[model samples]
Target: MSTNKAIFTMKLEPELRDSFMAAAAAADRPASQVVRELMRDYIERQRQADEYREYLSHKVQRARAQRDAGDFATNADVEAQAAARRETLLKQAKEAGV
Candidate 1:
């Protein structure tokens, strides 16, 4: 972890600020630690969401390119193949008593 640190200041309603401090004290954790954890979690979630959006965008572009090139599988065809694979896997698992 980096040793660098910065101070963040914000104004909050007195009631909300007191409630947050009380909750933090009840949990036996410093308010700063809880705020840091919440900030980290929020940042990580946003990062993951952005990554997933990029992944989907790429997939859509690829699918469009394939369609334009007349080299694409129909939804029904893909579903049928997936179902067949699932059946084969199930059969193998049954044979293995899995």
Candidate 2:
């Protein structure tokens, strides 16, 4: 055990407390360790969620800028280009008998 430690108190429902105690006893470890590990996992998940929110915000801003600058293709333009490519691919596939 480390000499550096902090003291804190937690209030748990009876059922939850019993479950924690049972798990600790089964593992031959302190309940505090299980609680600490659960807390650490929760904090890491929250941090990842925050990072993903920031990434999505940046992507939305970039998309808004592109739309305002008219740097986009119309649906018809995209469909026409895709159709042409599809025709070429189909021709190649037919030639290859695939």
Q: How well is each residue in 1-98 modelled by candidate 1, as lDDT tens digits?
A: 99999999999999999999999999999999999999999999999999999999999999999999999888999999999999999999999999
lDDT for model 1, on a 0 to 1 scale?
A: 0.98
Instruction: Write down the TM-score of every candidate.
Output: 0.69, 0.85
Give each model's clash number.
0, 0
Looking at model 1, residue 79 earns an lDDT score of 100
Q: Which candidate number maximizes lDDT? A: 1
Which residue pairs clash within candidate 2? none
Cα lDDT tens digits for candidate 2, 35-74? 8899999999999999999999999999999999999999
